[model samples]
Target: MKIWGEIMGKADDVMDICLLAGQIMLTYGAETYRVEETLERMAKSASFSNIHCFATTTGIFLSFEEKKEKEDLMQMVRVDDRLQDLGKVTDVNQVSRQFVAGDITIEEAHEKLTAIAKAPMQYPLWLIHIAAGIAGGGFSYLFGGGWFDLIPAFIAAVVSSIVVVEFERHLKVRFAAEFTAAFAGGTTAILLVLIGIGSNLDQIIIGSLMPLVPGVPLTNAVRDLMSGDLLAGVSRGAEALLTSLSIASGIALTISVFL
Candidate 1:
């Protein structure tokens, strides 16, 4: 009876650990199917043959069927905060793979995941600023902006990235922060055009706007729909739509004011 108790306790602990790992992946912008697959894999690692998991954009559900007890171990976790951190997603995948391969115990897996969750930025702030500027300029050139327009576009994008990064430090809502950043980009482009810094206002503005695009959300939404997760897909699609509209409105409002 004591050995049986220990077995049940260990099972419970593994379940909780798996749930926490899934939660971290979901909250950090992993796809629904990926989260479910990872949870299933983790359960298999613990010798469970009957594990079912359902993950959406905002929540996760997991259950393990116990053959002897004729009962199911169930857990539901609510996820509120969502962010796009590809690094975290990749790290979680590695940790899950390690756990399944018997490379680490459940407690060790939990500690590794926690550390990944708390990991700092991989790149410095100034490097991000430089990359943003280069991306803006390169995209503008690709979109047919002439040589003269590159400098203006670069400057606008750098300034936009800085403003958005600063706003993010204080703003909890992503939409608000994106809108403010887009508006700053628009305002900068218009000012540059007025001062004869660039001849093509449209090119410069478009380039600067590239940074605020919701690429990951849209891609994930499409993938979710393809995987038959209609509700999660629709929810993510709506978020992407709102972000696009916010960006457009920022530019339109700025142009309207100048006219």
Candidate 2:
């Protein structure tokens, strides 16, 4: 009876680890197919059979049977508040592969996964802001803006990025944050051009807005569609579309008021 108990306990542990792994991946914007594949691989490595996994934009479901006891275990995890943090997804994938390859035990894998979930952002906030500015400046030049437009674009983008981050932190609503950021970017571009700091208002505003685009979500939506996960694809595509509309509405409002 004690040995049987130990086996059951081990099975439960394996299930918990698998759920945690799937949760981390999904919460950090991993594709549904990748999350399901990782769950299956982890469960199989634990000597489970009849494994099944289903993942969506907001949840994950997994079931497997323990070979030792011939019993089934199932788990469902609700994932909310997704963000584009491919670094975390990559870390979880590395841990999953190591566990499957026997380089790490289930407990070790769980520990690593937990650590990753708790890890801070890879780049500091100030550094990210600076990078956003550089991207805006570069995009402005690429889009035919002269050197005089670069500094204004850079400043506008940096301010927009900061406003988005601050608003999102407080409001927890991305749509509102994005809208405010767009408005702020437009206003900044206009002010800079009026002050003789920028040569082209259009280029400055366009470059500033680039930082707020939902590029990752749109790309992931397309990838999911191509992979035949129709439900997830549609859900993500809709989300991307809504975000794009938010950006466009914000910019339009700004243009109407200022220009």
Best by TM-score: 2
TM-scores, all models, native as reference: 0.93, 0.96
**Model 1 per-residue lDDT at 52:** 94
Score each candidate by Cα lDDT: 0.87, 0.89
TM-score of 1: 0.93
Please identify model 2 stretches exceeding 4 Å from their true place.
none
lDDT of 1 by residue, 1-259 (tens): 9966876887788788788888888887898989999999998888776889998888899998656665578888999888767888898999999999999998899899889878886788889888888899888889888999999899989888888888887997878888889999989988998999988888899989888888888999999999998988999999999999989988988899884
Q: Please list all clashing residue pairs in model 1, or write none if there are none.
A: none
